[model samples]
Structures are given as C-alpha cells and as structure tokens.
Target chain A: MQTKETIVCRCEDITLEEIKSLIDQGYRTIDEIKRVIRAGMGPCQGRTCRMLIAQELAKYYGIPVGEVLMPTFRPTVRPVKLGTFAGGE
Target chain B: MPKVKETEILIVGGGPAGLSAASAAANLGASVLVLERDEKPGGQLIKQTHKFFGSKKQYAGDRGYQIGDLLIEQCGNNPKVEVWTNTTALGIYEDGVVTAEGRAKHLKINPKKIIVATGASEKMITFPNNDLPGIYGAGAVQTLMNVHGIVPGRRVLMIGAGNIGLIVSYQLMQAGVEIAAIIEAAPTIGGYLVHASKIRRAGVPILTSHTITEAYGNESVEGAIICKLDEGWQPVSGSEQDLKVDVICLAVGLSPLTELCFQADCQMKYVSELSGHVPVRNEHLETTRPGLYVAGDVSGVEEASSAMVEGRLAGISAACSLGYGEDIAPKLQAEALAELSELRAGPAGQKTLRGIMNLMDKGGAVC
Candidate 1:
C-alpha cells in the first residue's frame, strides 16, 4: 500500500503511490511510466529517483539490476534555467 | 548576435581534472577554454576540507579546498586559458562541435581538441523509505555544509564506509553534527584505515557487513533500520536494529558520469572496480575517438590527486594532437604516469589498478 501524498520526485512532487499505481496499471518500463507520470523529468533529471524506479521494476520482474533498460541519455544533463535557452537563433 | 566560440582545446568541467588539463594545455601554448556547470569552478573540491595523500607536486597534506584554490589560481594565471563558470557543456558532436548553455544564452563551440572531465555523481542505495526528503547523497551533504554552511541535520546515519563515507562522517562531526552510526555492507571497511580510525576515535561505531534495511520516517528521516549481512549480502533476520537519526547520508559509492562519452561514441566498459561504466581509453587517456580525450572520474572514479595527473596526461596528449607540446608531451606523460602509479600503490589501490589494467588490456606497464 502506497500513500498518495508520498512524494517521489521532489522538484515536481510526484508521489510513490502514483508511480506504483502506474506500474500496476501496466506502465512497467521507465519510458511508459515517464509518459504517464513525469517522475524523472524534473530539475534533477532523474539523478535522485531514476534508479529507484529501475530497481523496483527489476525486483518485480525477478531480474538483475543491470537487466533493467534505462531511459534515453539526453544532453543538458544538468538543468538549465528556462531563460538560458530563450534567446536568438 | 550569437557568435561561434573557437578554441584549440575545449575542456568540459573545471574540477581538479579539468583545471589541471587547462593549466597543462595552456602551458604548452594551446588556446584552452573550460566550461564548468557550477557557479564556482572547483567542482567537488569546494566541499572537501581534509588533507590529501600522494606526491608533493599535487600539494599533498594540504586541505582539499585549498588545493582547489591553488589549481583555480594556476588556471586563472595562464595567459592561454579561459574558464567560463555557470556554463553547461551539453554534448559533443561531429566535426569538433559542442553546445554550451550559459545564464541567458546558448552558444556553439568548435575546438580542435576536447577533454571530458565531467567527473562522477553520487550513487544511492535502495532501502525502504529511501525516497524520504531528509536522505541526502554524500556530495549533497558536503556541499550543504561546506558551501552553503547549512547543517543537514542533528544526527545522521552514514551508509557506506568507503573514503567518501568515512571522510564525510568526520566532516559532519567537525560541523557539530552527531553521527548515529556507519553501516557498511562490506566485511572490511572499504576506505583507508587512517580515515576509519579518525572517526572511530571520535566515538562513532562503524558496523561492517551491515546494511540499511529500512529508514523510518513520516515526511523526513527520523530513524533507520540497520541489519548485519551474511557473506552473500543477505541480511540476517535477527540483526536488525532501529536507530535514531534525523539524516541518512548515502555514501554508498559514486559512478562516472560517462553519458556524454557514450553520446560521443567512446567505447565503455562496466567495471565495478572503477565505479561503474567508464570509457575505454589508452595510456594517454585518449578515448576511442581521435582528438577526444577523457580525464578524472568521467573516465573512472578515483581521488583528485590521480585525477589531476590523468588530466595532465590527457592535456599533453591533446596538445600533441594539435601539433603543439611536441617537445614536452613525452616527458610530461611519463612523469604523470609515474605519479599516478605512486598514488595508486598498496592494497588500497589494487582493485582500481586492476580495473585500469583491464580497461587498457595490458599489465601494470602504464603505471
């Protein structure tokens, strides 16, 4: 049982119960989970929360931690302020 | 107008490694520029206050932050070097092109040589209530106290007995924070005995072969459950104990932040001894890509001393690649590699040495 108010993503304040509910509802992978509920898309860019979700999925599938497929590695790994990109071409 | 920035050498990150790279390349007459994401250019060095080990050239036995200042000044003093703070190097692309984002604008950069000195990130261990707000990575805790002067909490439970964990535990004590205990999964302490002894004398108990089973808290960390583990790393049933702690600091480990290297098409190897997936580089720290180099924790997780040496090797090699430093590259590389071997000597560095050997596909000749 997960609490709806239990926060997972601190920047966006997404909750564990929300993530578990998503996983239980067939959003098993991180990609599907991210599309449904934005957990790792915050300022941290999943620095704090990404591996937790992957470990959870690995446990659920009875697979090793290395077997879990991670999300795509994108640039701008560190969060840039919105104004940083709002400039001329 | 957005003008394209040009330089002979582009070094990403300005920590001990990148700064060393800059100083080396600049000394060799290569136009050098460093892109640092932090507001200040010390990287993790700003958070360190303890004396370091290794050679005198690296300023061994001085406080870490002071060394950071020394390196910063050295880089700043170089006529050919320029450092941009608060600038994030996004990634490397074809034809020596890289993108960077500053405070209010994005810029395109083209350089003849590139060094990836992006360093490493703290790794978190899994446990119940691990998502609690009061739980912090070791680096985060250090930055809070050393940089922002904010004490994390009154009492803390440190998980992991590696160098970072041991050093931070002592630093927390210096900051007037109480350490509840240190729980490590390994049978023996993972860091040096010197560091462990300092904290042990401070009346902190380091429980070996133990793991944090759960953390108890409502909204913030209020307590933790630690259990002794068998050789298999499975927790023993009757060994669990709940301890009172306001903060849980995970010093479990660090992993090299090699995603940029991956994006640049550098070959990588998963070596746990090196702290996760690291790029496969040659003796000169040149990765699979020509004119592309790596230094410090981005190449592998190690201390700043060796990182600085590796940075020098990479810098000299990059300089040579661009038709500079021809006279000094050979001697500089040999001396740096020698310094690295001396630092990595003894039982402590055996695993890392092995990992480096495996990655290089050679024996200890590189040392």
Candidate 2:
C-alpha cells in the first residue's frame, strides 16, 4: 500500500495530512504530533514550526489552545566552533 | 598594499538556517561566506536521524544530517559560497563587520551584509548535586550516543517530559540503557504524545506533575528522589519517591546567546515568551545597531525552518543594504514572511508571536 503523503510544516519537515490523520486518531497534543511527525525536532528546535503545530492540534482537539512544550537550550546557543569551545588558544 | 578579501555576504553559522541563507544568497550570484564553529559543518543536524516534516522546498522527509550534506554539496557546487569550518565568530562590529579567530588564523571581514544564524543551546536546571559527573544535559546524551559511539550511563533518570526528555529517553533505551522513569515538573507532558507513547508502549512510565527534587549519591548519580508537585510547581509533602539510577539528564529549556548582541549595544528586550532577552529587530532581522542582523534562535527561539527563512531574509536585507541588489528584496521578503506565517500558525506560536508583537509595539529596547 502506498503511504499517504502530507507535508506538515515545510520549515520543520512536518506533514499536513500526516498531522490531520494523527489528530483524527486522537493524538491531540502538539508534543504527540512532534514525535510522530518530527515537527519541532529540526535544528531550529521547533522555534518556528512548533507553534504552528500546537495551534493546529488545538483546533483538531476542539479544546482551548495551549502552549507546546519547547525544547531546552544548551550552552553555546549559537553554533560555536569546536576550536572555540575547546579553547583554541 | 594590504590583502583585502571581499565577500558580499558573511553568514556566521553553519547550522540549517545559516546554510540555507548562504544557498539563497549564492543562488542570486552574491558572494557568500559561511563560518561554522564546529569541526564539521552541520550543527545539531549531525546528531538528528529522524525524518523531517514540511514542504519540498524545506527538504521535508529527509534527515537533518542529509540536508546538511546537501547544503555542503550545494555550497561546493556554487563557487560564490565559501565555508570555513572550525571557525568562531567572536563578535559583530559596527557596519556589518565580523571578527573571528579560527584554528589556524585570526581574520577580520567587513562583509557588506551578515546573517547571525547562531542557534540556541540547551538549558539545564541546577539543584544541589547538579554538577555531579554523571549528570548530563539531554543534548550531551544525544551527542554521546548519536555522534560518538558511547553511552552516557547504564541506567538514567530523565528530567522533563518534553520532547527532548521523551525522545532522549527512547534513544537511551535504544542504546540499551535502563530508564528508571521520565519525571516532569509540569502537570502535563511537554513533548508529543507519540514520543511519550513510544516510550510508554516500551514500558517506561511517564510521571507527570512530578519533579526531581534532588539527585542522590555522592560520587555520581546513584539515585534520585522524585515528588509530585502542586499546580504552582511546589512539591507536595510526603510524596517523595526515591529510585535507583546512575544518571540524571536535564531537558528544561533554552536561553538565547545574545552576549554578542548585548556587547555590541544592540537594543534588547526581555520577553519570557521568546525564551529571554533578544535583540530588538525590525521585520528585516536587523538589530538596533546598523548592519547588525540576528536570525535563528538568537532572534527569538524558534525552529530551524523559521531560522532558515529568517536567515535568508537577514542575508538578503544585508546584501541589499550593501548595494548588492534591491529588486528581489520585496519578493524575497514576501516569500520569507509567508513561510514564517505558516510556521507560527499553531497554538504554540501564539504566545511567541504575541511576545514579538509586544516588543515591536514597545518601539525600542526593554532595558
């Protein structure tokens, strides 16, 4: 059987129909959609796509929209050169 | 007289956003240079193996590292783009100048336009024994397992049920580590139900409304004491439960690395909604300081896709400011704005958009 193709957020690589199907299956949380679709798992760490998914999921669940759990930041928030991180002096 | 190296655009990050910006600018025949801090070009992408979601333009359905490889290839194919690995951009100066020191040489460049696609880092909470040897950040664990062929610990106690916590828990399991349980301070799981369910079906109990009050063990993490919390995030009495574990992983949140922007005297505002104090920039991603632009998480914590869009806009804006071209500015801006609008269309983005709008309405720096 051919898998249905759906693009969620072009930015984060999430699918549109995949998200809709997941919501139909009762996966209501934005976090749920992220795992299934890898919505906010990109390098931007879902900075852009996460909110879009959260709103979509909220609407699908028929509940008041809520905040999606954002990923935590690490040190050297900017991509630091390994040489810089290792103290290239 | 003096060696004058010239590039139309300087991108100061090799992550997804930075690379995308470079490709976008190079596609338009602009000279672009990408400086990455890591030994390898791909930032965070090297460790991510899962497929992406979104449009074909975003390269949806591909792994992050694969996308990075494609960007590297694209950069190679285009002579206009130059990538300098193992290089760190120390500061952004006035007039679009970027100061840097790499493994072999110290250099200064005054690119007409620059894009600061510096990404955000992982955030960890500090408890009494947080500094223990075995205690690691969730990202650290990922790097250890995904990047390097090593395991952080045999048994782990993951704190925070958000995506990082849940996904890392599953990864740890995949790496053959025993997960005691996933503990979260919030009343609900912060990550996706699919991730939680993946772990749940694998028999990992997710203890929501609970937190790691303290990590036990002197030398390393021998155990951790978890407890239920009230709605206000305070621990409840007599609900403490101790579990034997060897490692404690923190996946709390992230804060923008605006030290460079702050040092350069860019106007900043502290909005809890956007993670922390970020540079106050207009729609073009230009900071209050002329010629200084911010993108990726440094602007406001968002995903790589938005970062890429923001980075492209910032690059084009900087290039146009430098007389590269102005005809494509409106077209590029509209496309980027559209992509940005789509990314922020969901509920999770509401508060962040509100934060930005509030900052924009404030009309200047918060502090």
| TM-score of each candidate structure, all chains considered together | 0.90, 0.77
DockQ, candidate 2, vs. native dimer: 0.02
Candidates' RMSD to native: 3.3, 14.6
> Per-residue lDDT for B358 in model 1?
79
- Predicted candidate 1, C-alpha RMSD: 3.3
Q: List residue ranges in candidate 2 displaced over 4 A.
A: A1-89, B1-5, B94-96, B363-367
Kindly give the stretch of ten consecutive residues in candidate 2 chain A with the minimal lDDT sum: A69-78
Measured on C-alpha atoms, candidate 1 has an lDDT of: 0.84
lDDT of candidate 2 over B205-243, digit per residue (tens):
999899877776766678888899998888899999999
**CA lDDT, candidate 2, residue B268:** 75
Best by DockQ: 1
